[model samples]
Each structure stands twice: as C-alpha cells, then as structure tokens.
Target: MKQSPAPSLPSAEAALPRLPDRRQSVQSAQTGMVVLKGLANIGGNAGLTALAAHVGESPAKVHRYLVSLMQEGLVDQDPATQRYFLGPELIRIGLAAMRQAEPIRHAEPALIRLRESLEVTCFVAVMGNRGPTIMRIEEPGLPVTVNVRAGSVMSMLWSATGRVFLGLLDEASVRQMAESELAAATDDMRALLPSPDPIGTLQREVRAACCASVRDTYLRGISAVAAPVFDFTGRVCAVITALGASGGFDPSVDGRIAIAVCREAHATSLKLGCVGPPPAAG
Candidate 1:
C-alpha cells in the first residue's frame, strides 16, 4: 500500500484568526470618528474627566487614549487649567490635510485676487461648529494693518462670515446651534450681544443681506464685509470677507468691494461644483 500523503500545512490566510464582521468594523470606525470630532469641537483645553463625560466613554478608556495622544503631541494639557486643547501637532496635521483638499487649494487664487482688488486684507474662512475659522489670509501691505491670522476663530454672532453663515442656515437650526453648541460665551461675546434682539436682528438682516453688504461691530476700529461661498452640495462651506481700517474704506468703495467679493465667491463655488443656481447678481 502506498504511504499516506504527508499532512498539508495550513495556508497563511487560514492560519490567521478570523476577523470581525463588516458591521462591527464599521461601528468601531464610526465610534472613533465621533470621539475625535467631539474632542476637536470641545474648544480650549478640556479635562480627561470632562472629555469622557462629553463622549460618553469610561474615564479609564479615555485616560488611556489621552495619554497616548499626549505622548504623540497630538493633545496638550494646560498647566493652570489642566485641560486639553488640540495640540500643535494636530494643527500641523490639519494644515497638511487642508493643503491636499481641492476646495481649499482652489480658494487660494480667489483669496489672492480679492485681496489685490480690494487693496485690503482678505480672509477665506471655513465653517466650524464653533464658528468660522480663518483658513487663509492675504494681508494688506500697510504698516498698520488689521491682522487676522490663519486659524483665528470668529464668533458666528459677531463676524461677517459668522453672520453670512447664520443667514444661510434655517432659523430653528441657527437658534439651536447658538444655544446648544455655543452656550459658553466669552467676555467679548457677552458685550456683543448686549440684548437678545441684536441676535434676532442679525439673523433677519442676514436673510435680507444676501448678496448685499452689511456692517456690524468688530473691534473698535475694524470693520468687514462678507459673502458666502458654497460647495458642490450647494451648502455654504466657506465665506470670503474683506477687512480694513474702519476709516479707510469708503461706503461706496466698500459696497463695490462687497459686490466683487460676492461675485468671486459665486464663481469659486461654481468651480467647486456648487449645485445651486448662481447667487443673484449684486
């Protein structure tokens, strides 16, 4: 009789342990995204205990991850408050990521054009849960210039971009956002909203101010005009605004700059595949 054939060895693929189902894998990924996104939105330095509560995760689990993040410099703790904000490393990663996105890359040219045309500082801001974030800025050449640097966070209630964005969103949503998300206000923010009516008036004005120029308080001597920039989904993803010394921009010229800024924003939106019809001509 022929000898039995030697037993076959298990293949590498078969030798590996079986993986979890697709649904489980997807759930795990979604949970992780939620945690990271929530952390990013928490604003200034947050405590591990507070973060865990916010994310609805156990402190032990959050502590382990926070320690890991801290080691990698992706999160930092304030010595005074002992809370954590996004770390410099996270910002570096974010900048790198923004550089690779097509919408941001395309906005660069338009930002430069607006700055050159207006002869003042122009900023391109993207919507964030907190408010509008200054993603890019083309500073004016003047020695005494208003400096709004990249990553500056402007209030959705005070800044032009913030007003424009609030205008685009529905009333209920806007109120909900203001009350629920931005519940905590800074001293400056409290000063801006001396009464509740100003917020309502701003919202109503935002609705009427579409493709139009509106003035609101900034710092004591600074002012700006803003217009919305839509994305492919017809959602306003960004806003382009022109800022200058309060006295330097004449009302007539300011109107013209606002119109030009709006026009350019529309053009940029179209290039980005915004589905909505072009904003009514200014």
Candidate 2:
C-alpha cells in the first residue's frame, strides 16, 4: 500500500491550533488595560471583581493579584469596609503620572465653564469607594439653589452624579458594587431605595448610556443631567453634572443641558491632549 502514501503531511494551518482573531486578541488586551486603569483610579476592592469580569477572569484570580499588589504596597485595604485601595506605592506612582495629566489639573476651569453655560449647579466628581467625591462645585447664578458642596460624598446608588459615574462601569461590576454597599448599609439605608430591582435596572440604564448622554430625576423636586468624562485612553475618568431646581428646569431642559455638558467636556479633553472616542453628540 506504499506505506499509506508516505503518510501525507499535515498542512501548516492544520498543524497549529485555531488561534483567536487578532482583533479579539487586541480587544482582550485593551479590556485588561481598562480594568487595571479603572481600578487604579477608583481604588477599591469592588473594582477587582469588575476588572476581572471585564477581562473575562475569575474574581479569585484577580484577588490573588491584588493580594500580591498589597504585599508590595501597591494597594491597601480599608479597615471599615475591608475594601482594597491603591496603596502608598500607587500614591507615589500617581503623583509622578499626574504630572503629565493636564486634564486633571484643568478640571476646575472646564467644570466652571460648563456650569456657567448651563446656569445650574455644576459638579466635577471623581470616583471613590463611597461614591463620586465632588472635587469642585459651581453654584448656579440663580438665587435659590441646592447647595451641594465640594468634598461632599454622594451615594453611588442614588445621586445623579453618582449614577452617571456608575453608568460608566460594567453591569456585573455595578451590580457587585451595589450589592456590597447594600450589604454594608444599615437596614434603614436599604429601606430608602425605590425597590429591590432599582439597583440592577439603574445600572443597566447607566451602562447603556455609556457614550451617550443621559438624564435622571433624583429627589422629588430636584433633577440633574450628566455626561461621562473620559481620559486619554477613553476610560470614564470623571463625570460632569448640572443640577437645577426641578421646577425651573424642566426634565427636557435637563436633557439639553446634558448635551451641552458633554460637548464642553469633550472640548476640554481635546485641549488636554486626551485621545479617545469623542462623546456622543446630542
């Protein structure tokens, strides 16, 4: 039988295992970068789970890496919530890195312009464990207003700004965060929520509006509109929100204001040399 035709050689393509698409491989890498950068910016244990899901990894594996990071002092744990945060090493790293980040430096002026344009209370907030921490606030020109000051911490599950920030995060991550906070919160705190489904529903709405602008009604008589702000890598770095008296500013107006805020934020990002996908136009 001519030794089975000398045993035909396998083709080069057949010799190799099926490889993942190059585009998919690139996306996987990018996803990992996004998760890492998000964790660095947000600085919380909940972020690890989010990052893991974003990269299609298990939380335990992510936790192992985080633990190693902690051992090296690149991360720390919060005593109150036992959540992890960027440690002293990261503080040093961030200080050095931020030197090249002009957007963060110019955050105040951009926020000021957006506020002035909208003539509503505007806030520039950064992500945190509790929620978005108000880095700066521009009170509206109006006489009567809601006075939320800088440094005030808003609930990630409630306030408009916080919701916008949460919207930037992935669904599984948001759900994980909400559940963690809900578990930590008092019974009275849980009671304040609209319903058990609000967390998941709100998170879905927020993520769906990632690149697009979105608006929401918070307190009975208070409404605010917001847009997600991205950094050079197109990660949701911060959120700029416009708040107004529910009576004076109609919900429709809030939507318009969100469009304007997103535009201004995009301009600012451009000025700061941030390269990323432009915010969705209204």
Candidate 3:
C-alpha cells in the first residue's frame, strides 16, 4: 500500500497567526502622531481628503486613525463642514505645555552655546518695569568687562538689548518710556542718537533687521548684538544678547556673530512655541 502519503508541511500562508510584534505597536503609535501633527500643520483643520494628502496616507487609513484620535479627544470633526479640527483635549495639552515653558529656562542653553562658541558674554533680557533687565547671563572663560549683571536694567536708547524690545514692542508704555529716556538723555547721549527722528528711525531699523547691533554706543569699547525671542503669539518675550570688546566683536547685521545670535534666538523661540521662519539676520 502506498503508505499514507508523506505528511505534508503547512505552507507559510497556511500557518496560524502569531501575536502582534512590539515594533508594529510602536509603528502604530508613531503613525498616530503623524496624523495628529499633519492636522496641526494644515491650519489645524482640514477635510479628510486634504488631511490624507497632507499626511501622505490613504483616506481610509487616515479616517481610521482620526476615529481613534476622536475617541481619545485629540481630534474632532465638524458635522456641518465635514472637516477635522484639533479637539479640546489637544488644545488643553498644548496650553498646559506652554504654561510649563519658561522663557529664561528655554534660552539658557542657547546662551551657553553662544558664550562658549562665540567667546562672548551672552544674556537673556526681559522687559521689566525699569526697562530691559538682564535675567540670565553666560560668560566665557575670559569674560569681557561689561558692568551689567543679572538684574542690571538697560537703556532703551543705548543698549542693543533694549533696542530690540523698543523696536518689537508696540505698547504705548514702551514708547512712553523711550521718549522719557530720550528727553532726559545728556548732550552726549543725544548726540549718539540718529538725527531728525531717532525713535522713528530706530524702530524702523530694528524691525527691518529683526535684530539690533550697536558698536561703542552703549558703552565705550563694547559692541553687542540682540535678537528677539518671540512666544507662541509672536510677541517678543525676551531678547538674547551677545557682547564683547568692540575690537573683537563684529556687530554688523549680517556678520557671523549677529547671524549666530539670531539663529540661537530663533531656536529658543521655537522651544517657547513660536512658529515662523527665523528672525532675519541681515
């Protein structure tokens, strides 16, 4: 008798299913995140077709993910427009994250990097009641002699740091303070200001440059560059400044030092939730 035909082995396709792999689980999580981020990048709301195109996924796959996100309150769709938008939970999470982000804390690393790489004194200055006040400072091994300290208040018309605030902040308080300072400026300080229309000219220049640099204007032999660090609302929350002896520092708007400062400020602003291109260096 033909013995029973030799036992046949199961083909791979006929084998029983194995448990889901860990990597697949991780990938699923990552894909979910991609969907969420894609929704945010496209003005925070979009039709399923648009969102699928933006995320480079099929509409069916995106819809499945969107359903899961909705279950978790991370996304929601409007019945009338049939468009998906970020949900309340996601907004709450973002707001909570923003509340935890401290401008000084976010800027400290940039300040350290600027100080070490550029061999200059770098600081974070905030608009305080007195004016722009230094909140944090980093100095190189051989620091320059700039009398200012952590709490030192800078002059709106005299300091590179203050000028960034003066140019970016549109509040009447800032303008009033600048005017008061200009009115009380000594003959030497007045002479140092631009002729004809110092305030108007300074604001226009700083806004145009997206940064401010001064040479031998704030203090004798001292040069500095300052760039604004904006918050999520595109408001100037602080200024990052790097200063050194005029002989060693290049304060030109397009110079290496200024570009570095602007880049660093832009990075710190990103950490603080600001969205946009980096501040213009030149």
Candidate 4:
C-alpha cells in the first residue's frame, strides 16, 4: 500500500542493541564491590562508623553487608576491637584468579615482616609489559626517597628488580625485556654498555643463586636486593626486593637483607606450589 508507506525508516532506538533487564542485575554484587573498595581505600581495619562513612552507607546498612560478607568469609571483624578487615576467603579467591598472583595476596605478610625486621622499603616486582615493575611495597616509619612505587618500572639492566627479571626470566623473555629497553635508549646511552657480556654473566649468577641486586647504580645512595619467587613451573614469576640506602643495604647472597628476601621468596614460592628446596640438593 503506497509502496509500503515509502519504506519506514528504522528508528534510532531500534538500531541500538538491547540492554539486559535491570531487574536481572544483582545490585548486591555492585554494593559488595563498593564495600570492598571502601575497605581497601581505608587500608586496614575500621570501626563500623568509619567504614560506613568511607563507603557512604549508613552504619546499619554497612553492618548488614559486613555481616553477610563475614558469613561468606570475604570480610572479618575483630572481636576485640570490632574493626573490619579483609578476610581469608578473599585471599584464596585473589590467588586463584592468576597463576602467578603470589605477590598480590600471599606475599604481603612476608613483606610486612621483612619491612619490620629490616627497616627497609621492601616491595614485590613483576614483569610488566614495559619491564620489571613494582607491584607492592611496605616500608618502615621513615621511608627513604627512592621514588619507585607500585607500577614503577625499574631499569632492565640497571635496577635490582630488573636485574632479578634479567637473571631469572627465561632466555627469550630476558632478551625481549632487554631489547625493549635498548630500543628506547638514546645513542649516547647505548654507547655506555661496559662490555658485550655485561649483563649475561649476571644473569647466570642470578639464576644460580636465585636472586639479584643493584646498589648505587640507578639512584646514588639507594640500593636494592631482589630474590626470585618461583611458580609451580619453577619460573621466576615475581621477585621480592628490599631497597635501602647504599651502605645500609647489602646485595650479598649471605647478607641479612638478602637472606631475608631470599627466605621470604622461597616461602612464598612454596606457598604457590613450587617444589620444596629442590630435594635438599642430595
């Protein structure tokens, strides 16, 4: 009829994809994430009133959700102080989310211990796309001014974390990391390599000893020692680094800080399901 009414144009609403039903969405899950985010922002245990303020929820509402989260083992409240902190179930879930997520949840306790014992700024590093990058840090009351923090990329050939990555990563990965940095280096910087074997030898020793370090190389008066955290595949998935002043921090294998880092790394690796101690070396 009338050439089908001149072929009616498609409505703009019709061109758009249909959204899922709002009623089907779980609002509670979104609320849960908000509560978790609020807890993280608070950085530790908080009283009911403080937590409510942080999450912008009423105390009664926060308490109800906290009770539910506690039942699910996602949040915990201290019986003595009535303060809230994250719970163990969240740790398990976080660890399960990534094969190499030791540093995200499992390594914090060890990092805290190291920081307290060594009075240094200890951090966890992982191989980010750019290079070895800091993922977490725990420092003493008076932290030093090294400038690197979570997400800071260390030097592939110069920084302790980068050296650990260079030392422990597979050959192909090591080459890729180095080349990525080299490709970005200026001509003058490229000419500064000490020799052809400058980094190769260190890689060998680092792999053999299962750790690496760089002192007063990147930032004068700053030093770092990094020990490998192996995964079930025995690959160095991450590293624990303790950075401090030049003289106060030792990169030596047997030194106090090195031993602490190596110990924590090994323990975390074991927790991640790597074989224990290589059968005691016979």
Cα deviation in Å at residue 22, candidate 2?
46
| Per-residue C-alpha lDDT of model 3 across residues 1-282, encoded as one tens digit per residue | 567788999999779788789999999999999999999988999999999999999999999999999999999999999999999999999999999878999999999999889999999999999899999999999999879999999999989998999999988889988999999989998898898999998999999999999999989999999999999989999999999999989999999999999999999999989888886789
As a TM-score, model 3 comes out at 0.92
Model 4, C-alpha of 88: deviation from truth (Å)? 26
State how far residue 166 of model 1 sits from its true place (Å): 1.3
Best by TM-score: 3
Candidates 1 and 2: which is better by lDDT?
A: 1
Give candidate 1 misplaced runs (Cα > 4 Å).
1-101, 170-177, 180-196, 211-216, 250-254, 275-277, 280-282
Question: Per-residue lDDT for 1-282 in model 2, tens only?
Answer: 455557789999899999899998787656444545557545344555666775567887667666767777777878776666667986787667656665555667867786677677777887776667788787756633555678887667657666766666554555566667767877666665657676766656666654222233335467676667666566667777777667766434236776677777777666554666665633
lDDT of each: 0.70, 0.65, 0.94, 0.79
- Arrange candidates by TM-score, highest first: which order? 3, 4, 1, 2
Clashes of each: 3, 0, 0, 0
On lDDT, who's better, 2 or 4?
4
RMSD of candidate 4 to the truth, in angstroms, is: 18.6
Per-model TM against the reference: 0.55, 0.54, 0.92, 0.60
What's the lDDT of the predicted structure labeled candidate 1?
0.70
lDDT of 4 by residue, 134-226 (tens): 888898999998788898988887777787788668768677778777678776655544456656776776777777776677677888788
| Per-residue alpha-carbon lDDT of candidate 1 for residues 208-246, written as tens digits (9 for 90 to 100) | 656423344555577777877776556777888777767
Q: After best superposition, candidate 4 residue 230: deviation in angstroms? A: 0.8
- When summed lDDT is taken over every stretch of 10 residues in candidate 2, the lowest stretch is 209-218
